[model samples]
Target: MALPGRSVMPTLGWRWLLIFSSIPSFLLLLFYSMVPESPRYLCMRGQTSEAMDILEKMARVNRVALLPGILVSDKRIELDENSDPSEAAHLINVGDGRSTVVSELESKTGAIMALIKLLSPEMIRPTILLWLAFFGNAFSYYGIVLLTSELSRGSSKCASYPILKHSVGSSLYKDVFISSFAEVPGLLLSATIVDRLGRKFSMSAMLLVSCGFLLPLIVGQKEVVTTVLLFGARVCISGSFVVIYVYAPEVSTRFLV
Candidate 1:
C-alpha cells in the first residue's frame, strides 16, 4: 500500500509509512484507560478488594454468577513445583483453622526478586529456552527478510537491461511485498493447529518444516523456485514465531509481562 506513495514521493513516502504505522500505538494509548487491569496483579499486590471487584465485573460481563468466598484476603500459599503450572488453584491458609481454594496470588515483589524467581531452579530451564526461542525467531525472521534483497539481486529482471537504474529497487520492493503476504497464511495455520497440537509440538513442527524449506536453498535454483521456497520457509518460521509468543506466557503464570 505504501508502494504508490514511495513511487510518487520517495523522500516523504517512507516517513509517511512510519507515521501511519504508529497510528495503532496511538490508538492503543487512547483506549488503554478502557482496558481492565489484571486481577491477578492486583491480588498479588494485596489489593484483594479491587481484585474481587474486577472479578465480579468480569462475571457480570460474562453473565455468570460469582461464587461466594473466592477472594479471601491475607493468606500465604506455597506453590508446588510438581503441580500443573497451568492450574490457577491457590491454597489459602489464613491460620484461623480454615482453608480456602482460590486462584493463585503472590505478594508483589521487586524487579530483582522477580528476576531471581525467573532464574530459580524450577524456572531456569524454561527461562533459558524462552530466551533462545525468542532469539532464534527474531534472528531468523529478520535474516530471511533482509535475505530477500540479496536473493533477488541476481534474479532481478532489470539486471540484464542495465539501463533501468530504479528497476532493482522496485523489484526488491516487489519481492519483499510478496514474501510478506506469506505471513497471512502462516497466522491462519498457527491459529488452526496451535490448540489441537499444543504449543511445544506446534512450534517444533513449524521450525522443522521451516528448516526443510530452507535446506533446498543450499543448492542453486531458478529465481521462481528460490522465491517459492523462501515463501514457504517464511510461512513456517512465522507460524513458529506466533507459537513461541503464545507458549512463553503459558510457561509461567506468575511472570505476566
Candidate 2:
C-alpha cells in the first residue's frame, strides 16, 4: 500500500505524497485508541481495583483462570525500603560497581547532575562517539525517507525507468504509502538478523553494504544502474537504521538505558 503510493506519485510528478502519508498517521491514531493502560501502571498509581480488572481481562484473553486471592491488598505493597545499602550490597558489586556508584551519585546530586558528571574527561569521549553514531544514523535514515521520491526520480540505464517521468502531483500520497510498506520487510529482516549476528557487526555490515550500493550512482551514468543501486541503498540503509535503534539502547550503561 505504501509502496504503490511512493512509486506512483514520483513517477507521475505529483507533489501530494505529503498529504497521502497521513493515511498511516490516521491509522496509528485509531490503533492507539484501542489499547488499554497497562495493569502495572494502574497498580502503581494506587488503582488496585482497576488493575485487578485489567488483569482479569488479560487472563481471560489468554484463556487462563485468575487464582483465588491473586490480587490481594498485601501484594500491592511498594518496596520503598529495598534501596537500602545493606539490601543492595551484594548486587552492587555484581557488575563493575558502576551502577552502584551512579546510583549513589544520583541520590546525592540528582539525575541531571549525575549526567553532567558523565560528560567529564573520563566519560566524554565515549559519550560523544555514541551520540555521533546515533545522530549520523538518524540523519541518514530520515534523509532518505523525506527524499524518497526525489531519490527515485530521474533517469536510469533502462530506456525509461519506472520513475523517470513521474510527476510529484496526485501520486504523492500513494508514493508515501508504497515507500512505507517497503520498509516493513527491511525492519523484519533487521529484527531477525540483529540477535543472530550481534548488533555492531550487523549494523556496520549493513551500512557498508548500503554505501557500496550507493557508490555506483556517484560514478555511473546509466539510469538503470543508478535506479537499481539507489533502491538497494535505501533498503540497506533502512535495515541498518532499524538495527541501530535496537542495538544502541541495549549497549548503553544501565543508567543511560
Candidate 3:
C-alpha cells in the first residue's frame, strides 16, 4: 500500500514512511484526552463520582436511560494490616441505599500497581500465559513477514517453478503487497467466527492451522507452492492476532473478584 509513495520519492521516501507511520500515535495523543478513563479503575481509586459521570455520559451517548443511584460509593473503608495485602482495599456500593461490598484490591497506588496485581497468586498464571502467547505470535508473525522478501528472490532450484519464471527477481515490495492482502480475509474470518467458536477455540484452531501451513515449508517445494503456503500461514496468524487482542483486556477485568 505504501510502496507507491515510497517509489515516487526515492531519496526522502523512507523518512516520509517513518513520519507517516507515526501519524496514528500523534492522533491518539491529540484525542485521547477527551476519552474518559476506565470507570472500574476510577471506582477502585475511590473516585466513584467521576466514574458515575463517565457512565452517565456513556448512557447518554448510547441513548440508554440510567436509573438514579445505580452506582453509589460508600465512603467507609476498613483496613486490616494483618490481612493479605491483596485484600487491603475495599470498594463499597450503596446503590438503592443498601450497603454492599462491591470489590477489593490493594489500595496503595504505585507505578507498578498493575504489574503487582497481575503477578498476584490469582492472576500470575494467566498473565504469564498471555505474555508467552503474545511473544510467540509477534516473533512468528514478523519472522514470516521478513522471510517473504527472501522468498521472493527465487533460488536456482526454483527455476522449474512456473510462477517464479517470469518474476524471479521481484522486488520485496511486490511480495509484501501480495502477502498483506491475506490479512483482509483473516480479519473477516475472525469477525465472522470468533463469537461462534469462542476466543480460546478460535485462537487454538487458527494457530494449529497456521502451524500446519508453515510445516510444509520445511521441505523444498515449487515457488508457487511456497508462496501459497506463506499466504495461508499469514492469514491464519493474522486471525489469531485478532482473537488474542480481544482476549487481552478481558483477562485483566474478568479475573478480578
lDDT by residue (1-257, candidate 2, tens digit) is 46675566455543454455556778788789678777765554457788898888888987888888855433233335554323333322324678767768767787676678568676687678668878877886776566555544443343333444544443334444565665666777788888889988888887888778756544434435544555566677778888877776665563344
- In model 1, the clashing pairs are none
Q: Per-residue alpha-carbon lDDT of model 3 for 150-215, expressed as tens digits? A: 666654243344234434333344556567778879999999889899998998899999999978
Q: How accurate is candidate 3 locally (lDDT)?
A: 0.72
For all predicted structures, in order, the TM-scores are: 0.57, 0.55, 0.57
- What range of 10 consecutive residues in model 3 has the weakest lDDT sum? 97-106
- Model 2, position 198, has a per-residue lDDT of 90
- RMSD (Cα, Å) for all candidates, in order, is 11.0, 11.2, 10.4
Per-model C-alpha lDDT, please? 0.73, 0.63, 0.72
Error of 1 at 201 (Å): 0.7
TM-score, model 2 to reference: 0.55
Tell me the spans in candidate 3 whose CA falls farther than 4 Å from its real position. Answer: 1-110, 155-171
**Judged by lDDT against the true structure, how good is candidate 2?**
0.63
lDDT of 1 by residue, 46-163 (tens): 6788989899899998789889786865643454667432224443545433322121123334656888989989889889989999999888888788777766555434234322
Q: Choose the strongest candidate by lDDT.
A: 1
